[model samples]
Target: MKILVLSNMYPSPAHKTFGIFVKNQVEALKEAGHEVEVIGITNPLTGKKNVISKYLRWITETKMKLIFSGRKYDVIHAHYVFPTGLLALLFKKITGKPFVVTAHGGDIDRMAKKNPKIRQWTEKILQEASHVVAVGEALYQEINEDYQISKDKLSIINMGVNRDVFKAYPKKKIRRELQIPDGVEPVVFVGNIIREKGLSELVEAFKTVKEKRPQVELYLIGASRNQAYREELNQLMGTGVHFIEPLPQKELAKWMSAAEVFVLPSHIEGFGLVAVEAMSCHTPVIGTEVGGLRYLLRDGSGVLVPAQQSARLAEAIITVLENDDLKQQLIEKGEQKASENDEKKMIAKLERIYQQIS
Candidate 1:
């Protein structure tokens, strides 16, 4: 099988975290003996005032890349619905080949409503695609209901995890490198710092957690996309709550492995790939009970609190921290579930999809 992956999220050397899931899936397909090529995207924040220039640049760059190369492949696996999916749909029109699409939250959940024209394009392409991949059950439902896409065409395969990187690391060395005291209980929040991610609630919960255990430190490992929100968050942090930029993927696994608990208080998540990585490291996760998070924690690998409920988030964190037996149970269950997302399993499933579609 030959596959052409279309996504804006493919990781560049400058930003390894970006489009990593797309790269992982492509690798899985390739390891299954399929050939893979990528048409990665470039997303420039579209201003209400500058929408024309943004679209022109996007279309021009994409057209030149796809038209000039004229690559041949049996499978076109498009990661997002709008630009990537739309572009692939056009490529198919020109090349007369089949394609598959996977919607990873933002396209259907965020972009669809914000811009109706893009939504129309996405739906038309999805309606014509060979197959549709959903990251979780909620997203599966969301895609089906939103577009009236048939259940037969849809399947859920989560983003793969690198178990080798996420597994238990030398916590002492990682802590020393990050300059943290060993005795203090450290909890990490690792994602883009934004309101939708529920960072404010994490800060509030951390304050409550500190009230009970003063030695506890909250290490936030991300930056805000919205600068005004960054200013807003800056006001909430103090000596106990430390903010840092997102670490490299390899170093992040060490940080995840070192932490006592991994917290993701997002209001929405297509899939909690980071949470899976933490559990793979034998650390318990605490995530919001919204969107794809329910799918991630359904097996009791982690604890869930009502989204945006700072009090419950605080309580869940405290319980996971203070109760040793529960902590151990979560770790055991989480490690088991984490193995299910291994690259080998993901590759096998994707190979089946490629065969079926091609």
Candidate 2:
């Protein structure tokens, strides 16, 4: 099958972790004997002027590709529902090609609610697409309840954990390889370093934990898109907090493996993929009870605290660090959850969706 993938997010040298899951899916398709062509935004710079220029260029180039590409694609798959899906919808209208749009959280939870115009556009895209994939059960419910997209047209499918890249390693060995100092318990968070990701809350929570346990260190791993917000976080953050840039999957998995506990204190998440990756690395997860984290961390798979509650987050972190039994339980259950969402299984499901639609 020949597939054309349209995504507003894709990794580039400047932002290797940006939209990397989309790249992973494309690779999975190729590995499954499907020819995949991807058109996406590689730059993650976010000034207003830069955003406008990049989108314009992306749309123009995508239009040209749809017009002049010699080989006919079996299906068009879009990652985000609004702007990217608009292009897929255009191609479908012009050539009668079936298109599938995968809603990856922000497109629905944030982007669709940006304004009435965008909401209308998002609705049209979801309504017109041959199929829609919601990356989380919560997102699937949102589309169905808010947009009235039929259950037949919508499916819940997370971008699964690549166990080969995210499997467990000896924590001490990984720490040595990464040069992590001895006598420190590392609590890691891997995601955008923004306010919405609850970095401020994480910092505050870490401060409390640090007060009690001087050996505890917080490692924040991801890019910061907002300079002002980054500055704000820095002011709130004192010692014992380290900010690291985005890393490739292999290196990231090492960090996950070395961590005493992995935390995702996001105010909202479509699906906390990083938590699952941490689980695959045999680390316990602590996340807020919001979005998919509620579903992912259920049944003692991990610890959950309310969003933006630094006190609660601090307590949970301490509990995980101090309670060996609970930490082990979380690790065991988390691994089981991660296994259920294996990358190979997700790729098979995606391939089936493509075949069914095309």
Clashes of each: 2, 0
The C-alpha TM-scores of every prediction are 0.93, 0.98
Across 8-108, the per-residue lDDT of candidate 2 in tens digits comes to 99998888988999998888889889989999999899989989998998999899998897239989999999889999998998888999999989988
lDDT score at residue 190, model 2, on the 0-100 scale: 96
Worst 10 residues of 1 by lDDT: 41-50
Candidate 1, number of clashes: 2
Runs of candidate 2 with Cα error greater than 4 angstroms are none
Summarize candidate 1's per-residue lDDT along 1-358 as a digit string, tens digits: 6777778666666666666767877776766777777767444233565556656665676678668764667878888877678877877888777788888888888888777787788789889888888887899998899899999888888877877667787678778886889798889989887899999999988999999988899988874567889889879875698887867778788888779899999988998888988988888899988888997897688998999899999999999999999999999999888898886787777678878877
